[model samples]
Target: MKLKDLAHSRTGDKGDIINISVIAYNEKDYPTLEKLVTVEAVKKFLGETVQGEVIRYEVPNLGAMNFVMQKALRGGVTRSLRLDKHGKSLSSILLEMPLEINN
Candidate 1:
């Protein structure tokens, strides 16, 4: 399975920083996400696009995690020539992360 099977995501950007919020469909899945989703994992997944650091904040009460990625926008929307300068597409791409389904 993939993370998308358990959660949905929203993305926003400020300057060269990108913020992606991954919200689990149920509270029960929050723990799994907390364990499997790490700042290192996200940074690795994003690869060279993320030139700075990745910070993850857990919101257990909300059953969600927010990832703040710095220097990820290829220099902010106004300066970038990339079609998806805001990095909105990154949320969906992040969702593609594979996960083990332990039933």
Candidate 2:
């Protein structure tokens, strides 16, 4: 399955940072989300796109987690040549991450 099967995403950006939120469709799925979406996992999943560290902030009350990736935007909107200047499309890209969720 894909992360998108159990959750949805939102994104924001500032300078070379990318902030992504992965929110579970149901609170019950938060554990599965936590298991599959680690900081290392995100770094590996994103590859070289993220040049700096990725931090995961748990929002259990909201059944969500926020991933703040440093140096992921390549240079921010005013600097990068990338198509998605604000890196908004990255949420969709992250939702495509492969997963192995068992019900």
Candidate 3:
């Protein structure tokens, strides 16, 4: 399965940092996401796009996880030559992450 099957994501940018929030559709799915989605996993998924540390904050009550990626914007939106400087599409890209679904 893909992460998108269980959750939706939103993204934001600040300077060279990127913030992505994954919110589970159902509360029951939150635990699964919490276990499967780690900072290292996300960092690896983003690859060279992310040049710095990846920090994850769990919001158990909200059934969400927020990932703060440092140095991820290629030096901020204003300076970045990349077409998607804001990295809004990154949220969708993250949804493509493969998952092992256990029914």
Candidate 4:
């Protein structure tokens, strides 16, 4: 299954940083989402596009996880040569990550 199967994403980017929030559709899914979405996992999933560190902040009360990805925007929307300079597509890209949760 994919992360999108359990949650949704909201994103923001500035300079070379990207911030993402993954919120569970059902509160019960938060535990699994938290376990599957880790700093190392996100770093690997996002690959070289994110040149700096990835930090995960848990929002258990809200059933959400927020990620601060450094060096992700390639110098932000104003300077990036990439099509999705603002890194808005990152939200959807992250949602595509495969999750190993059990049925």
* lDDT of candidate 4 over 53-94, digit per residue (tens): 899999999999999999898887789989999889899999
TM-score of every prediction relative to native: 0.94, 0.95, 0.96, 0.95
Inter-residue clash pairs, candidate 3: none
* TM-score (C-alpha) between model 2 and the true structure: 0.95
Which of the two, 1 or 3, has more TM-score? 3
Winner on lDDT (2 vs 3): 3
Give one digit per residue, the lDDT tens place, for model 1 in 1-103. Answer: 8889999999999999999999999989999999888888888888898899899999999999999989998899889878999999999999998877576
Position 26, candidate 3: lDDT: 99
For candidate 1, the 10 contiguous residues with the lowest summed lDDT are 94-103
**Weakest ten-residue segment in model 3 by summed lDDT:** 94-103
| RMSD of each candidate relative to the true structure | 1.1, 1.1, 0.9, 1.0
Cα error of candidate 1 at position 69, Å: 0.2
TM-score of 1: 0.94
lDDT by residue (1-103, candidate 2, tens digit) is 8888989999998888989999999999998899889998888988987899999999999999999999887887789888888889989989999997666
- The C-alpha stretches of model 1 lying farther than 4 A from their native spots are 101-103
lDDT of each: 0.91, 0.91, 0.93, 0.92
Once fitted onto the true fold, the runs of candidate 4 whose alpha carbons sit more than 4 angstroms away are: none
Residue pairs with backbone atoms closer than 3 Å in model 2 (clashes):
none
Cα lDDT tens digits, model 3, 1-103, are 9999999999999999999999999989999999999887888888998999999999999999999999998999999978999999999999989888677
